[model samples]
Target: MSYSIVVDHVSFGWPDGTTVLDGLDAAFPAGRTGLIGVNGSGKSTLLKIIARELVPGSGSVSVSGEVGYLPQNVPLGAGRTVSDLLEISATRAALHAIEGGDAAEEHFAAVGDDWDVEERARAELDRLGLDHVGLDRTVGTLSGGESIMVALAAQLLKRPEVLLLDEPTNNLDLDARERLHAAVGAWQGVLVVVSHDRALLELVDQIAELRDGAVRMYGGNLARYEEQVAGEQEAAARLVRTAEGEVRRQARELVETRIKIDRNARTGRKAAENNRVPKIIAGARKRQAQVTAGRQRALAVEKLEEARERLNEAEQAVRDDAEIRIQLPGTEVPAGRTVLTLPLARAAGDDEQVAGVGGKVLETLVVRGPERIALLGPNGSGKTTLLKRIVRQGAQVPVRYLPQRLDLLDDRLSVLDNVRAVAPSASVNDVRARLARFLFRGDRANQAAGTLSGGERFRATLAALLSAEPPPQLLLLDEPTNNLDLASVRQLSQALSAYRGALIVVSHDLPFLETIGITRRLRQDRDGGLAES
Candidate 1:
């Protein structure tokens, strides 16, 4: 039984001295392994270390064979065609042919006499669900989902011994996700995938949990891991309560013993002259002293035990309650009869004289109070385009738009400054206080917006959006759950559910949409139009 990959006591930290993985030990065989953790829990970092992109500060990582890594975001080289990348193998064969080495005939034979590398490349593309994509097509022209498929096809062509994927399902539609899942399930190699998708985790044979700079393995899927966590949390809470009660009882007993000792010492001194009384009192004092000392020692031991138990309980509870950080300011205003109304066949202007018209996307849309609408569609299917058009048409209504990217924020400004900038008329102190409510307290408020984590950035954006004077009656979220941890996503879902305003969200997270009460869905057609179903 040979191991595909082995990580022995590996520790890693960023150049900025932020420690992530510590004393982590794990081994991977020829099967699927799911890595689950909270945001900033070092899932990506650990994967990179395995891929040899990042070196560990301590310990060692050993790989038995070639490793293929798929980054979260595929970076395509400019002007590179699918055939150009694939032809590298052919080029190596050609080099062997020119050198006339001992293995030249073998290389030529393996590549075939005619060496139709283009045909082989096309077949590989078809295998990865890119049958429509041309072999000569530039990677730059591909959509987000298509680009991911192309990258995957390139890797599969080489057939590495182990594959490392980070959030591979992100940005993919339901159909594309299913296709990728099938492709991965069929692969014959070691797989280490870092993702929050519960559905995807079901395909894995084992799950590894990363928490507090350590990794632990469990033999099951995400559902089973969640069940185990829930059980541990309940047990930890019970232990904590029990320890607290015992501590309280011991404290009371110690106090009573001290009081009795004081009373006995006073009584012993007062009855010094009485013969029988003095003898009895002296014995009482001796016994009282012994009892007091013993009680003190016992209390110390009990306190130590209780402290250790409480610490263990606290750690377990932290693992159990994985909550996302999302807090929107409460609004007293009720949603109006029509939160948004769009015109039929409206022209969305682009550089080339109105690149498209709204038909399936928007043919007279109207949203009512407290209605959760999910804007579901493929990449470049006008989800964000429809959102912008609605916002422009519904200017009369108070709206809060959280864009997918935080490019709307000023990077140079502090988190507090950004919040204050959103509503300059408000006092700085008041804005800072509001920010603190979102967990940006004290010095954190002074930190630059650029330095904040993905979760913190979303919180800052939310703070800015909610700080408006009249408050927003309609909330527009564009991929709001993207790049957020499971905990943060849950918090955002709960916060949105609590909001009285209407919600118009465009997201790829089906689970999040279902949780946020999206009763209506907007899907886009292949011809750049939306269809409401």
Candidate 2:
């Protein structure tokens, strides 16, 4: 029960009255902890409060030592250099000036005792797979993945007792992700990471789940947590069934008891009217019967209420994640039908230049029926460029492409409107009904696409793409799981499972690709030729 960070009676809300964490109390111990939750479950907000990036509305947080936080989105200054990001620019400058024969007191003060600051900076960068990123290089020159890695290096270089990382693996490619996983594994101080990366979570000593505005700790890693949850859910389900049966039985008994009591009263009244007994005696007997019947009815009602209460309690234990259930028969392509033909390589007699092909041209890539193809490549290997070319060239059937940025959505338009735009022929009611299957119901379906969380936006975008006007038989997704949480990843897999169409997905998430049952795996060679891996 020793702790590194403590949050007491914490409460936070936005100006728009969106309550995130309410009276939430949690403690993080000195070990690697994986923080996970569904989208918008306040995981990021809690991390920010712990990091002092945002102030909590009430309550307090205490940390045992210095804290370093790497936010989900690392703010990049266009003019800042890697040295500046690592926070050693001042010290490095002072050392350089002193070495060049400047006796300013400020230089001596800035250099302090950290004469090896430059070497330490380089070591930290190299540890995080950023050795190639020079200290003097501008941050703008790095890719998104490299920028995040550099930010992490900056935190590591600080040597803080506590480190908080929010979605640290979000933008990292496969190699960068591996390096990050290694860093997490090697950390000796208190480390808490909020991420959707399953591989990263596997390295954590414990899993802290943020759900329903509370944090629950589970000993061990993500796999252990899932096993526990699955078992708990099964037990909850059984209790619910038993509770439901009891409620139904009690309801039936209550009705029957009332009927029997009424029948007895009627019989007594008839006997009294027939003068079977003296008026005084009959009146007393009737009063006694009335009291007994009243007690009986009250008892029945109490039992019924107790049953309902038990049922409610049982239901609360179950986590109800609504599944997306939809049959898109229109999207089904016949086994013999051609879905698409993209010239992944150059054509003979065609002068079109293919980047990175190195003169090794591939034949026209043909997709038929409902084949699931995984498009794999390193960053900047022209995977996205090839996808764009395919989209521009068009498909043999109705096609839809969901790009990495999710820019397909009209920011101002509601989710309902966005989906309806794609399915112009479908009625509003029809579109909304389909959206409900994607977990957008009622006012949720009316939310502006721009205001949605990363997971919500992904769901909305998928809904729109799947529910297009002509019912796309050829679906293309680029890095679909880039920012999705684990639950959202499962949701995406479930949604794609129901999709009976040809799919070409560009992704580095091998586990996710497995879930979708990819029929073929195609790798983009360094020379730009697409080959089966």
Global lDDT of each candidate: 0.74, 0.88
lDDT value for candidate 2?
A: 0.88
Residue 522 shift from truth in candidate 1, angstroms: 1.2
The model with the greatest TM-score is: 2
TM-score for each candidate, following the candidate numbering: 0.83, 0.92
Worst 10 residues of 1 by lDDT: 350-359
Give the per-residue lDDT of model 2 (tens digit) for 489-529: 99999989888999999887778999999998776754566
**For model 2, the run of ten residues with the poorest summed lDDT:** 351-360
Report the C-alpha displacement of residue 425, candidate 1, in angstroms.
6.4
Runs in model 1 lying further than 4 Å from the true structure: 85-117, 273-336, 344-362, 392-394, 408-417, 423-448
Per-prediction backbone clash count: 6, 1
lDDT score of residue 182 within candidate 1: 87
